[model samples]
Target: MMNITIKRIIIGICTTIILLTIYLLVPQVSNPSPSYETKLTHGTPVSDDIRAMLTPSIEPKRTRAIMVMQDGKVIYEYGPTDKIMNGHSTRKAMLSLLYGIAVDKKLINLDKTLSELDIDEYIPLTTQEKSATIRDLLMGKSSIYLPASGEHDNQITQRPKRESHKPGTYFFNNNFDANALGTIFIKETETSIGEFMEEYLAKPLGLQDFDSDNVIMGSPWFMPKKKTMHEQYYIYISTRDFARIGSMVANKGRWNGKQIISEDWIIKSTSSHSDLSNNHINYGRYDGFGYQWWTASDTNTIWTDGYGERFMIIDPDKRLTLVEQNFTGNSLLSSGLWLMNKNMDSGLSNLMKAHKTLAKNK
Candidate 1:
């Protein structure tokens, strides 16, 4: 009788485990969300063959990815776009969009001097560095000079003497170049950069999943106590999700009939408002800079650049957009000449030609 009782208990436990496993493994089916059509302007046309033309070039690059959204529709998408790829200064452009939202909500005034706030408390530096304004930082002309290049290359050295280029005159991406600005946002809003970003931009834009996975609680690179920012590479976003961001910008910060960011800030941030005309940051592209965004040679072309050849290209004039994400290599260690760096030029050239053809047809 004792043996039988023990056997019964074991069988019961095993049966329960099997039941749970089946419940977990079996897929649950539910009503799918309603599909929505992309809004295309009447008579507007994008070349039907653009994706076909671009695909042949993509495979040879090995790690290349591409996605095109015409008038808010995923006309084409390919490769590891949903992968958590490293974003270098492309993040800087996204941060610029968030800054615009902060400005719209009166959290921080673009003209407000950084010295007026407790920016010094968060980032250690002299009054000169602290004197930089939000506008200066956005314009990439803040005199806050630091010796760093590319992503994760945070080697900052204060110039013994400030340069004569004058504030709001040059462009640099030193980590110290953006550090004080983050501190400025914190001081003005009584919150960290990441928190302010979520409250103002992500939530409104339906981007809760951005920092949901692989969160780094507080920033690992900066002063630890601030707890204002987090630094994790695993921002889980798909090509379409990223294209949605570009669409919002192309629509003047309006997302699905809602204003996610102020239209005025959108114009200022994407325009060629910088003094540095047609400057090349990576290799052989003469794109202009505005705030943190890059203005393409074409008046209507604007983009936010990311590391590993990731790009969110927006052309409002043509009512078209494209977002591509790939894991190429760190620019600093990129062996000087990688195929990925050249990918944009060839891709954009094809895209531009396609756009022109479509325009002519219309």
Candidate 2:
């Protein structure tokens, strides 16, 4: 009888161990962090009325996520809040913010020219291209006509010949300019841009979804010839974290009362530096170019939009920041381009409508 009892106890223990192992192996859906206030106690609650207004505007399959924050609190959220998505060109805005901090710390000089830094090791820059200053590149006025990788826009790839326009005179939203700026940023700061951002911006801003591992550095697929330049770089982050970055901009570089980035830099970077009204690449109405940020001519809003229907729009006047993420596909060169464009148009229209609705409700 004692022997039988021992066998039964062993069996029970083994079963318990197996069950515990199964429980441990199974994935658990964690509760949202307490830092993020999902409750609508802070600002105007995203009421049923608002949801009804915004729901019809969204294309469910095309838009992966949307997050809207008002007065530094999340007023609305949709889709998986934790979903990580490629930042695409919207990463340029983060780079711009880093440039602001770098400038504020006197680590970078805006007047620095390409020639002085010897930035043309791969394909020697012409005298005019070399004359393009860091400021000009930041302002999207760099006239350097080098073929840029990862750029799907026909306007830039089929643009005029090199040195057709003087540096700082004309504005073309070219990836070559942004890539060159990234190179310059690394050379001047004596550290990788991603490392700097992770240390300074991401940490201080409390970006829950950003990891330094997500920073991709290398050449874009289109430009195989430019091996030395490594022109294409991107950062993958969640829409919620993107909203946090936008909120920082909306609050004039202040996050939780701490001056994360200088307010002066924010003002300068978001201010209109180029007139993009006549440009064929339509970035909605009242579109203008700033320091890697898009400015609206009609409203006091600054935004960064990516190729794959991802956007972070900040309206300082309204104290609002909206971030949208839509994953079209791996490559913009594919048939996904049409869907991407459609998604972008629909998303922007809905966001604007929602903003108007919020204003009217308030």
Which one wins on TM-score? 2
lDDT of 1 at 257: 80
Which portions of model 1 miss their true places by more than 4 Å?
A: 1-48, 57-63, 120-126, 148-161, 192-195, 207-209, 212-236, 278-284, 297-299, 328-362
> Cα lDDT of all candidates, in order?
0.58, 0.76
Given candidate 2, what's the lDDT at residue 228? 46
Question: For candidate 2, lDDT tens digit of each residue in 162-214?
Answer: 88899999878888888888888888999787788878887788777655655
Q: Write the per-residue lDDT of candidate 1 for residues 1-362, one digit (tens) a residue.
A: 99999999999999999876655443222111212223222223335576566565435554556666665555666675544444545667766776887777787788766566545432354666666777987877766654322324322332323554556666655454555555565567776555665566556666423433212222323232422221322232445556767877878888768988888988888887654443323423435778777776754588776555567778877656777666543222342245435554335555556555544543
Candidate 2 pairs with clashing backbones = none
Worst 10 residues of 2 by lDDT: 27-36
User: Which candidate comes out best when scored by lDDT?
Assistant: 2
